[model samples]
Target: MKLKPTIFVFAIWATGLCHAYASTSHEIECPTEISAAALAINAPEGWSAYAQEGLRLRSAEPALGPPEEKAFLKPGSTKSIKGGSIDSWLELSGSGPTGKWIVCRYGERGEITLSKKLHDNTSACTVSSRREQVQVSCTW
Candidate 1:
């Protein structure tokens, strides 16, 4: 998929492209605890794992070929394979189910540590953003 950069124009003063605002950084967080099963059931069809956290769907059978690349639009997402580098995407390992799943490492300095898998029974989640921070709040 082609990525498009979002540019914000503030003012123009007859000096070419005057002022443009672009967000350089982003933060991904799910304030309310959630579970893999709950995520699989609750998340929308095209939900981003980066935005939802641990919401991966896998088939009972193994994948036929190599893993695919999953892009996370938000910040703090890591690169594929040896996922230490911070990026907006990840290379998912194995074959996911009908839905999309991004499996990559991102635990490094400045990255938020994911909480242990637990049960929450959350049926819906609301995502909000302010500046660079992305918040995901869930409810039953």
Candidate 2:
């Protein structure tokens, strides 16, 4: 009976300690040489753009939690914004506490399409425009 109390106390302490170190907050800076068009594209609804040595994109949605991985093109890096294709990687960080986040890159082609597989659900997006103006919308 006495052991039960002691075990409960230890378990609570261990859980608290784990939660304390679960997530970290840091400021990400953006590169200065990014193209005007890239700069103009509004970050996803809940992301913030920062200007640091390297362009770092931070998420502002506390509910979605911190990002596991972030993706962005380096300044002066020219990617083919045509044929509805892009070469990008979804960066990940944090552990299971932070749900998975995705990076969808699309070209500035006519009605570009972007799709991602999240677990069993596949999400699709489209970017319609080729000039400096690009628009993107995603659907699950």
Candidate 3:
């Protein structure tokens, strides 16, 4: 079988486009003070949970607990990006300066939704709605 020149060119272009889209970066712009480690879900909640769900992730299982992966987070950057997971919600929960707690959500489609300042002891961040804005709850 012989492929036409135009067809071949389109095919190459499409392949390149696909690769770019697949590797596209989803970035979250947080203040410089936030460290990569602090911008993610911590232990006793998201950590243990993600370890448990790692199997589910490999088997295409549903999300079992708080979000673990960076999804599309920038390397060594705590921007709390999205678009890594195809269908699941992940979180970033931590206590900020002076124990100001915060939680963020990294959705299945690579969407990052950071919660308002929460209680320092909050262990997880779950999504909800309040005052027509994306509200997140810190629990456990």
Give candidate 1's whole-model lDDT: 0.29
Which tens-of-lDDT digit does each residue in 7-115 have in candidate 1?
3232233234432322122222433333444443455788755344532211111112222322322432433333123233222222323332212222222132233
Could you tell me every candidate's TM-score relative to the true structure? 0.21, 0.21, 0.22
Q: Rank the candidates by lDDT, best first.
A: 3, 2, 1
Q: Report the alpha-carbon TM-score of model 1 versus the true structure.
A: 0.21
If both were scored by TM-score, which would come out higher, candidate 1 or candidate 2? 2
* lDDT tens per residue, model 3, 1-140: 98899999999999998876452212222222223344445568444522222110011111223234222222122222352222223333343344433334343433443423334444333333332223333343
Kindly indicate the candidate among 1 and 2 with the higher lDDT. 2
Q: All candidates' lDDT scores?
A: 0.29, 0.34, 0.35
* Candidate 3 clash pair list: 67-90, 82-110, 83-110
Please give the lDDT score at residue 56 for candidate 3: 9
